[model samples]
Target: MDEHEQVFQMDTGDYLGDCDYIWAESERERLRRLWLHHAQQLSDFYIKNESYIAAIKVQEKVQELFADAEDNYFILMKLYELLNNSGCR
Candidate 1:
């Protein structure tokens, strides 16, 4: 299967089938923290490297923290789009 199909398939069992939701919130929080932490690390690295592209990418991910803070998926998607148009993807 293609990458998109593989990704969709990998997640299908979570919601499409009789799967457990015991760790869903915990997993999501874990991932959120991981992404935020890594974005900080990338910010530091980009500061040293002066990588404009990488900085923009890190900003895009940093914006995603608002998902947990305010559930602002629209803003997050906008940031993602901005980063994509910034040629950092």
Candidate 2:
């Protein structure tokens, strides 16, 4: 092993994946995924009900929340078009 590797065993476990460190991060991840699922369901319901305008409005609200996320903006527009083309209505 290299000198640095021998000096410090990284797996000392003193601070590895501690509850305090992982709790908030994992919770955020879980909530983020749940939020996306509900948002998609809302859009799907709006499309199925033939309320395309309301679906777009929901997308707009999501866009506002993630205004700095260019990829999300693109996805929002794509979802809008995809929902519009869906034969659900």
Candidate 3:
């Protein structure tokens, strides 16, 4: 028997598959948080400058990324309210 085999008896394929699954999940989560941060920063900057339309666009673009997901609904609604109250269409 090989020295490596003598020390470790678990199936390598299963170990690799588990590792890949974990890495993929963590990577997806990291990307989601990153996008959310970027969207928030851009929206806040546009709103602070009184660019309500641009702020709404930013939120809408993020909504597209998430695709009808509940997480973005609140921000989208807030942006719409801001635009409506500002008379910016």
Best by TM-score: 3
Off by over 4 Å in 2: 1-22, 67-89
Clash count, candidate 1: 0
Residue 65 alpha-carbon offset, candidate 1, angstroms? 5.2
Q: Which is better, 1 or 2, measured by TM-score?
A: 2
**Which candidate order results from sorting by lDDT in descending order?**
3, 2, 1
Number of clashes recorded per candidate: 0, 0, 0
Alpha carbon lDDT of each predicted model: 0.50, 0.57, 0.65
* Model 1 per-residue lDDT tens digits across residues 1-89: 24422332242222222545665767765765665565555555654565556555555545543435543345345545655776866
- lDDT winner between 1 and 2, please give it: 2
Please estimate how well model 1 matches the true structure, expressed as its whole-model Cα lDDT. Answer: 0.50
Residue 24 lDDT, candidate 1, scale 0-100:
75
Q: Tell me how candidate 3 scores on lDDT.
A: 0.65
RMSD of 2: 16.8
What CA RMSD would candidate 3 show?
16.2
Q: Which stretches of candidate 1 lie over 4 Å from their true place?
A: 1-22, 64-89
Candidate 2: deviation at residue 70, Å?
6.8
- Candidate 2 Cα lDDT to native: 0.57
What is the Cα-based TM-score of model 3? 0.60
Q: Residue-wise lDDT of candidate 3 within 1-89, one digit each (tens)? A: 23322222231222243465765776666756665676667678777888878777667766766676785688778878887888977
